[model samples]
Target chain A: MNNRLKILRAERDWSQATLAVHLDVSRQAVNAIETGKHDPSLPLAFRIARLFDLSIEEIFHDQN
Target chain B: MTKIDATHNLSESAPSSVLRKVLITIIGGLTAVFSIAFLAGYTVAVTEQGGLNAYAIGTIAAGLGLIGLTVFISYKLWPKGTHEAVPAREKKSQHILWAAVVIGVLLGGYMAVASGDNPDGVFSNEPVTASFAVISIATWLIIVPIITWMWWRTIDEHEADAYREGALVSAHVYIFLAPTWWMAARAGWAPQQDPMIVLVIVSIVWSIVWLYRKYA
Candidate 1:
């Protein structure tokens, strides 16, 4: 999965640690998601979507 | 974007940044040297008297080096006030984990000293003493389970997922490897399959997977 998390975070002027705090996840988790190494769970994806006021499809694109 | 890139380049070339990098590299090198020396000392101690003493000395040196590295990394990563926003549960979990590590290190020191020259102590299944057996059994069978439960509860979904994947891979490896080793032992192509060695291999594989998934 590819994500616009890094760009979104940058637009908000938020560091990974700051974004992690907002999402109640570890900084490493945010990094992994941004680097396309791990996909967020449904609830976490929803949280991310809510945080950015955007749909899941807007932030993430399926590789397939 | 160009301004940001220029700023990043300027920061990288700063004297303080250069000094910090140099210090980190030096400390990292020292930590590696201490770790290697600790392992070498342990190997030598196996064939010599006062193995406990050697272990104590090695532990101190390695422990100090590790502590220094950990402190430096934490300082560099968290800065001063950045950690204040960490969730209460996360802070509690970190505390518990640190306490566990301290307890484990203390227990290891006790075992090294108490085991002495008992061939059955550190490496073998044979009981060293009644007290040693009690402590070891209590720590591994009771305390460990409780700590593991707490850890599982405190960790986020990402860590839990990593742990699950590690467990799955480790189980698969054990299933295939154990049967192969058993057949090889029967054919006299290898030594008899030792349960302890199998357990160690499984554990190492599990830990490698877990760390890679969690950190990489």
Candidate 2:
């Protein structure tokens, strides 16, 4: 549930909308994920990691 | 309401002069209210007259005219939305939704018009009435639901979540609202219950809440 998605997006100098476009999700979805209001499904998580050119662990951390 | 962009410290003010905006909004609101009143009165008055007359025609025209005026005033006061291009897929899906809506209205309108005065169900033996009845039933029961389901499946997860949240809200509202209406009707303070109309009302609320969650 805890992910550094916001930081990763910022590191790439991307707006949420920009990141959302790449991820094929809404800006609201990206915001919700970053804000920890929702967690991405496994496939989406893989897609996000692939987009960032990192492994899943690099992008997401288990808060549990 | 102010929108705060998290990515940037963006500040946007009203595009029009504040005083002019306020004046236009007030005038537009009054016009819209009057148009609604006229339409309501026309419906009742025209029904009592048992046919279309000068009074009915004039009332309909006046109501429509005021509505047009309000739309014009609203356009002048505040333009609709941003010029951001909706994705082509989204646009296509929106078109589908619009098409379904238009079809539903046409079918429903035909049924209402063909029913004569009181539609005695499919056994009425009236050709136009029976045909429109079948079409309207199919429109609502089959066509509309298919279009809605298609629209729901095509949206992103966030938009779907908005829909889910909307459904939850509507469900909660109906839990209280249906009982209150039933209580009131039982006590003779309200008219008899119509399940179909209540369901329609709930559906409207669901859509409204979904839109608010998506765009708010």
Candidate 3:
């Protein structure tokens, strides 16, 4: 899944570490998601969406 | 946005996914081997050894301790699914794992040799002795510093973490092996003449397999 995570994080002026802390995950996880190296689990996707106060669909779009 | 673009993106992301999949496969394989050996040793020792109660208790305690440690590390170090990739952190994590493996082998070898002779002969009734107990305790002490060093070196102020979780998993495996090692040593499986030649062989094979899987 390609996400605007980097852009969103930048807009919020938050580092990956800050976002990771907020999500209760490791910074590497955030990095993985941002670089499209790893896709987030459903729970984590929900958490990320909730953290940014956006719908999951808005944050993560299915390519297929 | 387009199918072509999506495919391109996926292709671009393939390498890390491949790496993660390979890692998972290797870990799963190791877990299987360790589990089989542990169970076999436990069964053999319980049936063959005299102190069934002590063996059972020791195995359970060691297993639980290892499981707890694995869980703690995983929760602390593993990425939660969103962090950006940091190559440096990944390298550090690999280094920590290598260090742990080296330390574990060294300590195991030391304990195997150090406790070869029954020094005090206190537990003569039992298979093991005061010397074996001392060695086991000493091995635990050595393991602590090695584990701590791995944690300290792998974790960073900014990198997205997933190593602690991985370490925790590794710890659980180690824990499961600890009792078997102790019991085997006590059983004189590692005699002065042969001295756990099988374990040494297995350890060498394990290392080779791990390296092949990881790098080859």
lDDT of each: 0.69, 0.66, 0.55
> Tens-digit lDDT track for model 3 on B90-136?
55665676666566555544433343333222212336557767766
Query: List-wise, what DockQ does each model earn?
Result: 0.35, 0.22, 0.04
Instruction: Name the regions of candidate 3 deviating beyond 4 angstroms.
Output: B1-130, B133-216
Worst 10 residues of 2 chain A by lDDT: A12-21
Model 3, C-alpha of B170: deviation from truth (Å)? 12
Full candidate order by TM-score, most accurate first = 1, 2, 3
Error of 2 at B73 (Å): 4.8
Per-residue lDDT of candidate 1, residues B90-194 (tens digit): 566667776676566556555655655442344456556788879978998998888888988987787778889999999999999999999999999999999
Candidate 1 chain B least-lDDT 10 residues: B10-19
Off by over 4 Å in 1: B1-90, B118-120
Name the better of 1 and 3 by lDDT: 1
Considering just the first chain, candidate 2 attains a TM-score of 0.94
- Rank by lDDT, descending? 1, 2, 3
Tens-place lDDT per residue, model 2, B15-93, is 1232344356546654564455446555655787697888778878877887897788688766444333344444555
Better of 1 and 2 by DockQ: 1
Per-model i-RMS: 5.9, 5.7, 9.8
